[model samples]
Target: MQVTSHFYAQLTIAIIKGVASCLRLFHVLGLIILCSSLSLPLHAIEQSSNTQIKQVHLHDNQGKSINIGQLHVQADGQFTFELRDEVFSDHFLSMKEMKYIEGPELWCHIAYPYPLNRDFNADKAWLSHDLLFMYKKSNQFGAMMWQGVYYKFTKEDGRLIGYANGVDLSEIASAPEQIHTPFYDESYMEPHNAQERWLPTLTID
Candidate 1:
């Protein structure tokens, strides 16, 4: 039987996912519940007293920090990502193409397939039963998704990893110059290392 490209791609992606699963990636089975607006969903587990949050520095390869944000996770399994300021929002990459497991608590999101890997931060999400996961997607540099949500999240295995929907990238290319500055609004500008990077991926655990 001759198979169509779409089917073939899906099969390949599913296989990759299977391998990833064996390697300890957790898959949440159910329909996705997207947030109404582009904001992190935290109300899902407000009653969980064990929920904890931490503030940390997001950095570039040269060790120069570019963004500031917080990370939130709950005992009920929720992840949220938020940005501290909008000054970083000005250089937002392709956000529509880069939707994540949860909404952005940060200004924008940067992943392997997008512009600055220096875009956003992580937060506990209400999606996947508020499972702890993060993601990045794009049409440029082709589409690439990475996730690590371990349901059996024990202290040894950790709680989250990034993810992808197992699809091909479309209408994506290296961003134009105007959209390619290290994430900054007029007030702040922090440069990265000399190396040119189109493949930007960062994860905060």
Candidate 2:
């Protein structure tokens, strides 16, 4: 009888340990699931593609070729462009506000409210930079890149070809209220000025 009781006690202890181990495993799995849920929003941002870098070149009014930077063009006609810091130091860009952007590489986008659309109004487009939020903090009306820019798209046997024309840098200096306005605000949307001749032509590869 004593041996029987001892065996039963040992079996009960083993069962208790198994249940405790299962509880610990469940707790760890729950924590992992919670962490994965928390990280989803950050990864949910719109990405042009899984990962693709396309080179871009700029042709000035004088017909000088300039290496702009890497670009990722989405099927929806949006563009993610990264520019080199040396491009800002060049004589082509005369804006003093360029100094305010706090980064060695400048990333700009033609997205959302101003995505490049061929079926829609394809002529007027805007290129806003990643640093626009920083300027917004100071309650200053500024854009890191061009606002009222001209873009034209062509279809070669159903393949879409994009072209960017004259961009006015002065649009960076706008009314202070423009700072408060949401990027989706269409009130400031307008055609590019004819006289503005910074990048006369842009070729996207």
Candidate 3:
């Protein structure tokens, strides 16, 4: 009887340990499932945040429409704006010239008679999109590169308005005598006289 009781006691202890091990395994699996479910939403939100704006209808304040060939937005908030109009093609300055023009009063010495033959490279410009504003680095001469220019446009009511350019020139001595707004309404007259005209402004519909 003594031996039988000892055997029964050992069997009970082994059975209790087995049940406890099973419970621990079930608890671990439940934790893994819960963690996996929680991570799915985070992954989805990340993907949504990186969404791109494929196309936006752009118009000017004068009710004129502008043709933007393509706009590619990146995850880091930088975008590329491509012009569809051939008239505006090859009318811009090189990125190297833009660096020198951004400084104070130095750009006025550059002559507009000789136009640069470089193509408008959208990859060179770094465009930033804020809540309702698009800011970009530009060249001072609409048809030439003499100074660095900055442009700020407000996107409201489905129209883009030219808000400001560069620092407030009211206090600067070297500022342009007349603020020559870039992107004016200019028709392409001739290949050599391209600088004599202005193009229409751009707005998003």
Top candidate (lDDT): 2
What are the RMSD figures for all models against the true structure? Answer: 25.8, 10.2, 13.5
Encode model 2's per-residue lDDT on 60-84: one tens digit a residue: 5456666657766556555566765
lDDT of each: 0.35, 0.45, 0.38
Candidate 1 ranges with C-alpha deviation above 4 Å: 1-49, 91-194, 198-205
Ranking by lDDT: 2, 3, 1
In candidate 1, what are the lDDT values of residues 70-152, reduced to their tens digit?
Answer: 65656654545454654233322334443332222221234323333221222222221122222233333422322222111
Model 3 TM-score (2 dp): 0.30
Model 1 lDDT on a 0 to 1 scale: 0.35
- Judged by TM-score, which candidate is best? 2
Task: Give the distance in Å from residue 158's predicted Cα in candidate 3 to where it truly belongs.
Answer: 14
Please write out the lDDT profile of model 3 over residues 35-143, one tens digit for every residue.
9999999999888677455443333334544444455555765554444443232323334232121211222112222122221223111221111111123433332
Q: Which consecutive 10 residues in model 2 have the weakest lDDT in total?
A: 129-138
TM-score-based ranking:
2, 3, 1
Model 3 Cα shift for residue 97 (angstroms): 56
TM-score comparison, 1 vs 3, better candidate: 3
Distance from true location, Cα of 6 in model 3, Å: 1.0
